[model samples]
Target chain A: MSKLLTDLIEALRCLPGVGGKSAQRMAFHLLERERERGLRLASALEQAMQRIGNCTRCRNFSEEPVCSICASSSRDRHVLCVVESPTELAAIEQATGYRGQYFVLLGRLSPLDGLGPEELGLGLLTERLAEGEIEEMIIATNPTVEGEATAHYLAQLARAAGVKPTRLAHGVPLGGELEYVDRGTLAHAFGSRQSL
Target chain B: MSKLLTDLIEALRCLPGVGGKSAQRMAFHLLERERERGLRLASALEQAMQRIGNCTRCRNFSEEPVCSICASSSRDRHVLCVVESPTELAAIEQATGYRGQYFVLLGRLSPLDGLGPEELGLGLLTERLAEGEIEEMIIATNPTVEGEATAHYLAQLARAAGVKPTRLAHGVPLGGELEYVDRGTLAHAFGSRQSL
Candidate 1:
């Protein structure tokens, strides 16, 4: 009932899946055992937002201008794996042992939600393709309808720029989030994939 | 990966039903949007711990030495309802038509967990009942086995104190939490009840 308690609970409810009861329980725990914990979380959020900028080359989150993967000479510079968001990129990094560099879209092609090619930074991607160092571009967007549409649009853009484009497999379950899938499944999905 | 971030996530994981994923989500949300919210929760927790003292008469959480309900001139002085926790008391209060005072056990008779009458402040309850203001003591502890045992033990205490001892009706689902039940179901359970 206190203002501080109410605000904490309300703010906790802003998470993707947290509900009112969960928010209350979280607030109670934070209040009871970890005052320092809350401050740490605040710092983490602020630091992550400030220090982790979009990689200039791949658009993945990184403290430097180019992410570690993109900067690494060991990685395959000719192969590029594209993804939607940082969370999704993290999920892919966790699941796959891919040595290729990445390019993050930050969002999918959701015309209905007003997310178009410009919003997804497709112009920059096309410019990168025109540089002609990349031999293959793997569309690792989700298997959702929006992901498919985004991949289709990216394929057209790649063709226009005289670059070869490919997509990740489609055997993943419909409406399934990449984060929920196991590493083995993701790897297997990646291994026996077809070009689209 | 920071120690503060790790500690914050661990602290968030201490809630009743929160898991690693939910805890991470909560930690992120608190960091992103709830800096003020987190501070508020911290303050509330501290304030509740500092200000909420046990009511001398009922052993329930209260800002005053004697809770507002126990000190109220309008509440039924002769009737008292006993519950397992402050959360349960809040639930009953939200049901909103009961004017009787309350006694919170703070815990049930979990012998395996080493909780007994004395440990649960039953001695204070006995001393309070000896004052003779209460004519009836209603056992509203949970319907769990330990709760039943606690109610039975308290009923004996109430009888020995020379007051009418009553128990809230059963059939409100064994092991079901009172706080989660709908208001109508709780009202129905309260209305059509048999003595334990």
Candidate 2:
């Protein structure tokens, strides 16, 4: 086997779910049939890795210093939604008629994993809350242990900042991927949110 | 969402089994965590797409004109194995000690899919057979209808070239992936090959 071929296979294993066999299949599929697409993917990867950065205000992925959502004037600044990750933020965007500004936690409060409030950029979030532009802070974190801990911490921040805090309704299934949950369930959960 | 993030997700969909959601997960996985690996994968993909080409003798993927297996002086020249794909060739390499030479068909005789003997590089195989260097030809195409057809055509070429032709034993489960067969079954099948 050629070293380049081996390197391609090894690099493909870097993908989230791709293991050794899958990496080999992907490598062969590209080399044998999808070379053009493979090259396109390479360029796309290069461009994205070099260009994309977190939104300075919301911590969501963005190529700009402040993401479009944070910079948009049409979105409601007073109704803020805080989620553990950008994936959940996207899910909310797709599943509901949400027009609020967002704060992406990037991760939850997992002390064992060394993910504290500081690591998750909670200080930035507190600053956004204290700015007095946000009236209500919706805690849209997943119902996991770490997520709940992060939500409690966020609720404290919201209360300290003199903002009303709320949690998603029980419509969301426990321990489920918030992004993959049914649109109706997620929408309903967002619509009928309860005070924390 | 950033346009580059969307482009990255779209580009990731080129992988065989990846779909919209998997593509999104891969994009986020890379952006949120594995940026370094993502860049490495990009480089690998670029190099492989630009450098890897067909081996002149075997039609297997290779950076060189002749693949390592075909160029190796230690391998026997009197026995040649005909496989439908490099994947199967790799399987044979791992599952059995049978070593001589190989001719990768790249595809089988799927006429509906526009694949024929010419598309499969049978002309090169025929020229190699006509060299009278190979005393036996092993037709290791899969047991699918198209694969069987390709094997028969290869057998005819071997007979015309005055070389005995053989086929794998029944130990290969019909319609199953040749590369994923258990080591015992594949090794036994190769060891107990029968004359076609």
The number of the candidate with the highest lDDT is 2
Cα lDDT over the full model 2: 0.90
Highest DockQ scorer: 2
lDDT of 2 by residue, B9-50 (tens): 999999999999999989888888889999999999999999
TM-score of each: 0.67, 0.84
Q: Provide DockQ values for all models, in the order shown.
A: 0.15, 0.71
Candidate 2, A177: how far from true, in Å? 18
Over all chains combined, what TM-score does candidate 2 have?
0.84
Local accuracy by lDDT, each model = 0.72, 0.90
When summed lDDT is taken over every stretch of 10 residues in candidate 2 chain A, the lowest stretch is A168-177
What tens digits encode model 2's per-residue C-alpha lDDT throughout A51-74?
998998989999999999989989
DockQ of 1: 0.15
